[model samples]
Target chain A: NAGVTQTPKFRVLKTGQSMTLLCAQDMNHEYMYWYRQDPGMGLRLIHYSVGEGTTAKGEVPDGYNVSRLKKQNFLLGLESAAPSQTSVYFCASSYLTPSGGRQVEQFFGPGTRLTVL
Target chain B: GIQVEQSPPDLILQEGANSTLRCNFSDSVNNLQWFHQNPWGQLINLFYIPSGTKQNGRLSATTVATERYSLLYISSSQTTDSGVYFCAVGDYNQGGKLIFGQGTELSVKP
Candidate 1:
C-alpha cells in the first residue's frame, strides 16, 4: 500500500492567491485530517472528516475549508492565502483498529511546504 | 478542552546516552501517542501507549493513565535520534481529536 500521499510537495503563493491541496489514502480509512505545523510548534488540526461526504472544523480551521467527496480522497482549500498561513501542511488517515483495541493510530503523508509571500 | 505539556522542552545528548521525555495532560485520556519528527519533517509513530508500558527496540514508553502522564525512554541514543518528540492525547468523546504538546527538541551529537 502507498499509505497516504499528498500532492504539490511544495508551493509558493502571493498574498490573496488561492490553492487546493489533495490527499489520498489507499488504506480505506474512515477518517482523514488536515493539519499544519509551524516553526517551534507541534502540528495542529485544521479540519477532519469522520467519513466520506462529512467534514468538520478542527483546532485551526480558519482560512481553510475541506471536503471529502470520495472515500479515498480529502481536499483542503485556501480561499485567500495569507502570510500567516505559510507552514508545513500534513494529511493523516486513521480507522478503528479491527483488533478491538479502539486505537486511532494516524498515518501521515510526506507533507507540503507552503510559503505565502 | 484538554491541555498537554511536555518537558524539558529541549535536550542535547551525546550519542549512546539515555534520556527520558515527559508528557503531562490536564485530564484523563483514553488515547495517547508518542511521535518523533525527524529533521526532515516526517512524523513517525513511536508508541500508541495510552496505559501501561510498551517497548520497541531501544525506545520504550509508559503512560500512567491514573496520573495523567506519560514518559518516553530512548536508550543508547544515536545521531539519527536528533529531532523533536511530541506527545498527543485525546479521548474518544472528542471525536478522536488529539491535543499536542509543545514538543521536546532533542539533539544527539556524535
Candidate 2:
C-alpha cells in the first residue's frame, strides 16, 4: 500500500497568498488529519475529517480549512497565508475499527515544508 | 485541552548505548502512541501502547495509563536511530484527538 502521501513537498509563499495541500491515502482509512509541526511546538492538529464529506476544526484551525470529498483524499487550504503558518505540515490517516488493538495508530506522510515570507 | 510533555529535550549517545525517553500527560488518556521522526522527516509510528508493555526489535515501550505517563526504551542503538521521538495521547472522552509532545531529540553517534 502507498499508505499516506502528501503533495508539494516544499513550498514558498508570500503573505496573503493562498495554497492547498493535498493528502491521499491508499489504506482506506476512515479518519484523516492535518497537522503542523514547528520547533518546540511538536505537531498540532489543524483539522481532521472523520470520513468523507465530513470535516471538523482541530486545535489550531484559525487560518486553515479542510475538505474531504472522497474517502482517499483530504485537502488543507490556507486562504490567506501568514508568516506564522510557515511550518512543516503533515497528513495522517488511521482506521477507526480495532485492528489487534483498541487504540488506532495513525500513519503519517512525508510532510510538506512551507515557508511564508 | 490535555497537555503532553516529553523529558530530556535532547539526547546524545554512542551507537551501542541504551537510552530511555519519557512522556507525561496532564490528564487521563485512553490512547498513547510513540513515533520516530527520521532525519528525512518521516513520522514512523513506533508503538501504540496506551498501557502495559510491548517490545519490537531493539525497542520497547511501557505506558502506565493510571499514572498518565509512558516510557520508551532504546537498547543497542544505532546511527540510524538519530532523530526526534514523540509521544501523542488521546483522551477517551475526546473522539481520538491526539495531542503531541515537543519530542526528545536523539542523536546516536557511530
Candidate 3:
C-alpha cells in the first residue's frame, strides 16, 4: 500500500501566484500534517488535521490554509506564494487508537519541492 | 510549546566509523522519533523511542523520559548515511503534533 503520497513533486510559481499541495494516505490514519523544511532549519508544522473535517494551525500557518474534507486526503493551499515560501514540503500521517493510544511513528511522503520566484 | 535541541549540529565520519546523536526536550513527551533526510530530501523514519532502547540493524535508539533526552547510535557508518538527522517530539497531550530539533548534519566519507 502507498503509505503517504503527495502530488506535484516539483513546482515553480511567480510571486502572487496560488497553488495547492495534495496529500493522501492509504494507511487509514486519523491524523495528517503539513510541514515545510528550510535550509539548515528543522521541519516546521504548517497545519494539521486530527480527523476528517477538522483542521488546525501549527507553528507556521500565516500564508497557508488547509482542508481535510475526506478521511484520506489533506490539502494545503497557498493563496499568495512568496519567495520565502519556497521550500520542500512533506506530508505525514499516523493512526490513533480508541483507548487514547496513538501511533508514535509518522509515515512521511516523498516530499514536494516548491519554488517561488 | 516544547523545545527540542540536538547536539553536534555538524558531524563528519569515515566509513565504518560509529557516531552518536543526542536530542533533548524541554518538557515531558509521550512520543519521540528520529528521522533521516537523505541528500535527495526524503525523510525516512528511523526510530520511535519514547523510552527504553530499540535496535534496528546498524541503527539503535534510546530515550530517557525522566531526563527528557534521547540518543541515536549509528554503527559502522556508510556513505549512504550522509544526511541530516532530526529528532521530533510529541507532547503528552498534543495529538501527534511533533516539534522538531534543528537536526544534526552528518557527512560520512568513503
What level of docking quality does candidate 2 show? Answer: medium
Candidate 1 chain A: 10-residue stretch with minimal lDDT:
A96-105
* TM-score for the A chain of candidate 3: 0.96
Tell me the TM-score of each prediction against the true structure: 0.97, 0.95, 0.97
Residues forming the 10-long window of minimal summed lDDT in candidate 2 chain A: A96-105
What is the DockQ ranking, best to worst?
Answer: 3, 2, 1
Among these predictions, the greatest DockQ belongs to 3
Q: Which ten residues in a row have the lowest lDDT in candidate 3 chain A?
A: A96-105
Chain A vs native chain A, TM-score per candidate: 0.95, 0.94, 0.96
Give the alpha carbon lDDT tens digit for every residue of B20-84 in model 1: 99999999899899999998998998998889999999999999999999999999999999999
> Which digits, one per residue and each the tens of the lDDT, describe model 3 over residues A11-41?
9999999999999999899999999989899
DockQ of all predictions against the true structure, Cα-based: 0.64, 0.66, 0.76
Tens-digit lDDT track of model 3 for B1-110: 79999999999999999999999999999989999999999999999888999999999999999999999999999999999999999953676889999999999999
Model 1 alpha-carbon miss at residue A91, Å? 0.8
Which residue pairs collide in model 1, if any? none
Q: By the DockQ metric, which is better: model 2 or model 3?
A: 3
Clashing pairs in 2: none
lDDT-better candidate, 1 vs 2 = 1
